[model samples]
Target: MRLFDKEKGLFISGPEKQISCASQIWMILAGVTDRETGINIIEALDHCPDAEGMSSPYMYHHRIQALIDLGLKDRAYREMHEYWGGMVNRGTDTFWELYNPQNPDESPYGGIVIHSFCHAWSCTPAYFLRKYYY
Candidate 1:
């Protein structure tokens, strides 16, 4: 309850004071939130037009897995298309540690060049493709 922001309709990192898909993912993974509430959280997040969103592919990877666990395959696919495919559409041969379609210069580390442009954290697609798609 302390972590969930009722006003925003998602879980958050208290100190950061931002709605966190990561927190919702961890809550679902750790069984802190029940199945129904997990679904509600996901739905609420979808409707939360102003939520900042997962900062990078690293955080988004867990979000994909969490969506899979919750049986939201279509939602997971759409999220992948939106995040990872956003990079693909840009002709990036490799996935990035940080990315923002609206602003390529955006970076949590203060500069775009400071992070991994081709990161290992983005390699889990094969796992999902094999286990879930195949």
Candidate 2:
């Protein structure tokens, strides 16, 4: 039973499966797989936008970080704005609210939670830009 064999038995599956695969591929290309792959995962991510909806901030953050890593500060800034903008339009105040725990056994916190998240989300790019580009 080979891992990553798409035709195998039971395996993980979902709408974001493609993005997960891409992340693994990117990691491999980034030399995390071996001592000689010597590939830039960040550049690879910058070239691929199909993984934009994986529901993982770390993944999305990495994509933006990759853009920055590749010296595309302006593009990264733009992408960050677009990303948070979409989240905002969806009524989520912050990215965390989209995934944060609401109560001890439920979903998001709602209301101020959304607003707080949005504020933080909106500030991220500006913070990054000021810290790295300015």
Candidate 3:
């Protein structure tokens, strides 16, 4: 699908054509097609560089939700545990606004100190786990 750019190895939104994981997640959530197609789209994400990878908990939350909707419960729970648990392993008392284990010190504002350590968006794992996994 043109929604995804195989050359760029990422999913792009219409018009602006901006590549973001959110687009893929939303399309899957909307039931774009079969589960295999959804799985392929997500697999394509692995080809993208870490800079283009999911940088926010907001996107992660949606991605996890999509996985659950696709009947990928085991993967969803595994990813939830890995992503969120990684932060916990790092000594995070609360979820951070942005997290990239590959580059833990990455910051959009040029400094890590400005990043939000306790963000509302990052707190939705509780709801997802309760409503779906638990």
What TM-score goes with each of the models?
Answer: 0.82, 0.44, 0.82
Q: Residues 1-134, candidate 1: write the lDDT tens digits.
A: 88788776688775877775666778887887777888888888778766666667877888888888888888887877788888888888898988776676688887887889899888767577778887
C-alpha root-mean-square deviation, each candidate: 2.4, 8.3, 2.8
* Number of backbone collisions per candidate: 0, 6, 0
Could you tell me which 10 consecutive residues in candidate 2 have the lowest summed lDDT?
A: 3-12
What 10-residue stretch in candidate 1 is worst by lDDT? 14-23
Best by lDDT: 3
Clash pairs for candidate 3? none
lDDT of 2 by residue, 61-101 (tens): 65566556556678777777776666666675556433222
Error of 3 at 93 (Å): 1.5
Worst 10 residues of 3 by lDDT: 44-53
lDDT of 2 at 105: 21
**Counting only residues 3 or more apart in sequence or on different chains, how many pairs clash (N, Cα, C under 3 Å) in candidate 3?**
0
Off by over 4 Å in 2: 1-53, 97-123
- Candidates 2 and 3, the one with greater lDDT: 3
